[model samples]
Every structure is written in structure tokens, then in C-alpha cells.
Target: MMGHGPVGVEALPRRVSVPAAPGSCADSLLERDRFEWRLGDPGDPATLIEQFLSTHDLPVTDLARPGDPRRHGDGPCGAALFVSAAAGAVLVDAPPGAPSPAAGVPDVAVIVYGHGPRHHPSAPPGPDGWWRGPWQPSWTAQQHAAAVDAARTAIARGDIYQVNVVGHAAAPYRGDPLPVLARLGGLPGARYGGTLAGAGWAIGCASPETLVELVDGRLVTRPIKGTRPATPAGRAELLASTKERAEHIMIVDLERNDLARVARTGSVRVDDLYAVRRWCDLWQAESTVSASPADGLGLADLLRAVCPGGSVTGAPKLSALRHIAALEPVGRGAAMGALGWVGPGRLDLGLTIRTAAADGDRLHVWAGGGITWGSDPAAEVAEARAKAAPLRTLLR
Candidate 1:
């Protein structure tokens, strides 16, 4: 019913394009015997999603939740799907009646899956770019102060533990993203780029956090919730932060509970707890939870039960999300979304944090951290800044 092949950029064949709109594709095309994939159709995305889920035997949990306008919509340009197995990555971009590439051609094709890549057309300087002046919150300091105050109040009321509040500052660029995409494309152990439902093209530089990975029927989810900067002193202080430990534990418990909904009795448990991970620029506190789903549990069901990841949303996820909706000025887009791959009898997904999005000339990046009861407004803001620093460097 479905298949994949590797199709590189240079080797792609010029084939007649499909005539479907951005969000609407004929059921007949989808039912074709050959492999068919798409980004967003011009019609109802939900219908298309439902059809894909059913056709692929994708679980309801794996499906992105509805109503998050950012996750499901007509993407900035067009819609396409890239598949890779033995050949490379096969891309099918159907930007409203645009000709589809030759079918069955293989190697790799251009399909930006996350928002980080599509948000900006060109790359900005890293530390020495246009020196777009010193970076500061786009919003006034007063607005940030208010958000901190709101977060403190929410923490006091037990409505949330740590709310990762974020701010944005504009970064202008005039370079093509192709070079960066090429560097990142198909990097081993790294699931590179793709377009998102709400966000445009993005790059996933995620390491250590396994949103969802299946191995021999075992489903694993590792969520990193606590952080300390990577410097020696920062690492020492971070390891000593009681608040960070508490936050990590809470999310782990929540994840365990989420897995239980679909897992067999006594099959859900924490495989690792409070493990420290040292990435290139920072240190993170993480925990791993594993579960074996019941006979009928599939990818979609597992995702729906646990999505809007607990680490990003905080404990008592729905309430925290509601509070977040009220407090956050702008939509998160793909900042806190999940990315990865889904295929026959297997899936791998990750939370889309520490990510950036580009669309044409505009570039958007976000950073936030948890706000527990012990959180200090000033300290929380500093943490968010630190988290956003590396991504800022890459964007520059």
C-alpha cells in the first residue's frame, strides 16, 4: 500500500506534476498502487489526515491533534512528503497543481519538514553576521516583567509547575537555506528537515530526547525537562538545582501515566531517571520511560494520549496548556511541536524545541524554560535566554 526510496536532488527525474491543490487531493490519487505522499492538501486537512492514518494503519495517537492551527494548515508555500528507505529521500511537493516529479524515482528529494529551515530564505552570520545590533526581546521589558509575574502567580496557584515562557527578537538574513539544508540533510542519527503543519520548513538538531521510538514492540519516550548551562560553574549549579530535579521528576511521572493508557498492565515504567546529557553547548537532565502497548495499540493512539509533550507544557498538561494559551502572546508554532517519522510498523518522533522556522524573508526562533514554584522571575528569564543562545548562533 505504501513504499519509500532514496532520491537525491541531482538524480531526480522531471515528471509531470500532480494537479491537486495545497490541501485537497483526490482520493483516487491517494489510492494509487504506487507510492504517494503529500504535505498539506487544499481541502480539509483533517479528512486527509484521517485517510492517511487509516490507510497506513497509523494509530490515532500518532496523528497530530486537531485545532492547533499551527500544526495543520496550508503551509506557507505548498505541500509535499519525502520518503527515504534504501534509495534516500523521496519528495512529493504538490504546491497547488504544480507538476509532480516522476513517480518511483529514488535517492533523495527536497522536503523541508520543520519550521527552522523554511522560515528564513538565507542564513544570517553566526556571531559576526550583520551585527544586527545587540539582541534584545522584541517586546518591551515591561511586557516580559508582566509575563514573569503571571508565571509566578500560576505557579503559586498550582496551575503549572514550570512554564517555559519565551520572547522573540528579529534576525534579518539574505542568504539561501540550501547550503545549510545540504549540510544537515541526512546526517547520521539526525532526522534533518521537513515542513510542519503550523510552521514551515524546519531542521531538527535534536539529540538525547527520544519523543517516541519503537524497537521490537517496545515504545520508548525520553523527555528532557531540566537544564543547566554547559560551563563548569553552570553545570555544578545546575546539578545542584533542586527545582530542576523536581520538575524533571514530575514530567517523568506524567509520561509514565500517559504510556499506561495504551500499555499493557504492569508494562509501563521509567527506564532511566534524572540522567544528565552533555550536548554541544548545554547540559540537560533527562529521563526515559518505556512501555509495551496492548495488542491493538498503534502509533496514533500513543501520540494523541501523550502529545503537546508534558516536558514542554508542564504537569497537569491540559491546564498548563490553557494557561499558556492565555499568557503567551504569540502562537508557539512549531517551537514545542514534535517531529520525526512514521512508517510501516515503526515510528520515531521528537519534541520540536530548540528549533527555528523560516518563511521567505522572515526568521522566527523561540526559547523557554519551566517555571516551578521555586522559580525566580529574573532567573527564569535568564534560563530562557541561555536556552535560546545556541539556536541564535546557528541562525546568525
Candidate 2:
């Protein structure tokens, strides 16, 4: 992970030059090619986010904070701050023969704040001037096939209903996150900036199905599990599908159990179940679970319990993780990991889905879906394609 000196908490004037066109900020931020931590004082995620919004002159209408999950025990410990803006002109596609970004920047940049360790020294530059790393998926077709066979075998034995196998791809870090994020677009309620894992950084274009919000000394977690095409005509059929509903319920149950471990007894409960939400190119089925902690459960503990999200992992999480480890080829890196902010008494995190990273000239985007006993390999591939479609178009 890349490291930098601690960011001072003193408020600075919000005087960033506006990009002439959308996504143009990449060129400026990348010119230096060095990562820096822009720190903030300890405060509630919501309040800090609001301050950012006001300071940046961002639109209030586009601002949103994750709701309270205390009543449902469904969210991370610290609060998160988020902001959205138009994605100006940016290139999402790779130009043929162009070099990747890895040659220019570090492989990974880990931000530190709150209660994490200090930054590590930056690594030597790559010979190519950009880091050149492989872009292999965590899971290969053969490995996926084997995992599916194992899952099927398990199902036949009636051990579990479904399992989510995750894969990873690691590349060198390019300069600024803005360029990658700009290609992601902000139309579909994209969030930017906040603390994560005790670090201050910005996450771009993350469409979270599960929102951990704080309300009235309580916490709420909303888990999104099922997804379908976002076309108008396909909407009804998508929501009516029983398969989607079943998958949604399984993850909901899993999330509740996770929260129950840290929440007060009888404090865990589902607030909303199987609700449909429409984004730019997809539709999702989501459920809201709430819980109140039994005093002493802090943000760090909550994060440790849920690092990789359950929706991305199948039921009986540990077994699913083992299966994923055996099946995938590369490390997921930050793909499925939570990214956001964590301060003294507040924490906010988002599952790193619908995100793209630059390795050098190559831009990497990862997508996958849950597989159940009824899953067809061909259909599973198709699901991944459907999920990647939005990102693919933007890149094009």
C-alpha cells in the first residue's frame, strides 16, 4: 500500500480550479503523480460531509449521508461523508498502444487517519515510467467451473443454498483517482471523499445497495442483493423474478447475523425488505436492517467483522471465503473491500462495486454475481456482462 504524511486537520479554503470540461481534473491531479492525505478533524461522518459540501459549493440536493443502522445493526461504525458532481469530459477507453498508469504512480495508496499506523515510504518508480502489473481476474473460467461444481456438490448434499465466489485483479496505481472516477460518471448518485479504515480518501462512482446510516443514536444497514437490467420494459419482470427475491433474502439474513454479533440483544431487525431501486443501467432489490449496539462496540470492531461484504460473499461466510481463495487467480486488492471514512466516534464505508482502477494505460473494471444451485454457468457469465455494461459504455 502507498503511504504519505498525515494530513493536517485545519480547514483550507476550497479553491480548486474547476475543470473546463468534465473529467479534466485527472490531468492536473496526475501531473505531480504523488499521493497525499487531506485530513479532517474528528466528527460525525454526516457533519463532516455537510461541511465539505458547503465549503466546496456543491449542490445540497446531490448530498446524502448513509442512514442510521443502529436500529438494525446493519452499517459500519464511523460515519462517511459523500459528494456528487457531473463527470466532465474524460476518457474511459484505452487508446491502442498507449502505456498504462502503473508506470507512473505507486501500486496501492493506503490513506491513514483516526487510529491506524503511519504511512510507509513510497516505492521506487517502475522502469516503464508507469507501473506495469498484470490484469488477471481473481477467478479463471476453469476455477469458476470447479467452484461451481463444488457448490453444486455441496447443494446436492444440502449443506447450503448459495455461495458467492470473488476474484481479484491488481495493477499499479496511476496518479489521481479523479480520472478513474470521472469515467465512472456522477449521474447515478455517485459519492466522493470521506474516511475509510482510518484513512482520508475519496471513492468515486460507488453505487451502494447497503447504506449504513446513523439516526437518533441508532444505526441502519441496507443490503442490496438482487439485480436485473434497468430497461423500462424489463423492470416489472426483473422485480417479479423469484430467483432475485430468494437471493436478496439470503444476504439480508446474513447481514442481520453479522450485525447481531455487535448489536444489543433483540436489537437487530429488518426495517424494509426486497425493495427495488433503479440506477442508470440496472435495477436492484434491497432490504434495510437496523440495530442498536450494546455499548462498547466501536467503529473499528464493526469494520473488522465486515471487511469484505456478505452480498459479495455467500452464506456461511468463512466457507465461501475459502472457496473464493481457492478459485480466484489474483488478489481482489480493494475491489470488494469497503472504502470510506472512519473517525473517532463515526464511520462510513461503501462496498467497492461499480468502480474502475487504472493500472497504467489499461483501465480495469471487475464485476461478478452470486451463484446458487440453480445458477447456469452461461447465465452467470451473462450476469457479469450485464453488470459491467454501464462501466463498459462509459469507458467507450
Predicted structure with the largest TM-score when compared to the true one: 1
Model 1, 1-396: lDDT tens digits are: 011122223322212112111222211111111223333324333233335545533343432221122232322222233221111101111111111121122112223211112121333223222222244455565676677789779888877776656565545444433233233222222332333211123232333356666656677888888777678886787678887888888989888987888778999878888877775567788888998877666443554565667777666766666666566665554355555544333356656566554434445566777777777777677777777666566555
Query: How well does candidate 2 match the true structure in TM-score terms?
Result: 0.62
Give residue 81's lDDT in candidate 2 (0 to 100). 31
TM-score of each: 0.66, 0.62
- Which whole-number lDDT from 0 to 100 does residue 361 have in model 1? 40
C-alpha positional error of residue 345 in candidate 2 after TM-score superposition, expressed in Å:
6.3
Count of backbone clashes, every candidate in sequence: 58, 53
Could you tell me which 10 consecutive residues in candidate 1 have the lowest summed lDDT? 86-95
Q: Cα deviation of 324 in candidate 1 (Å)?
A: 0.7
Candidate 2 local lDDT, residue 309: 68
Indicate the residue-level lDDT of 322 in model 1. 62
Give the range of the ten consecutive residues with the poorest summed lDDT in model 2. Answer: 85-94
Model 2 Cα lDDT, one tens digit per residue, 1-396: 233212233322111211111122212211111122111223333233334333432222121232332321221122233211000000101111112212222122322212122233333222232233444554566666666677767766766667665433334443433333454544374442222211223233445544454444556677777777777666787678788788779888888887887677898899898887866677777788888865665443454344456787677666666555554544443355444443223344556566554432344566677878777766676677677667655543
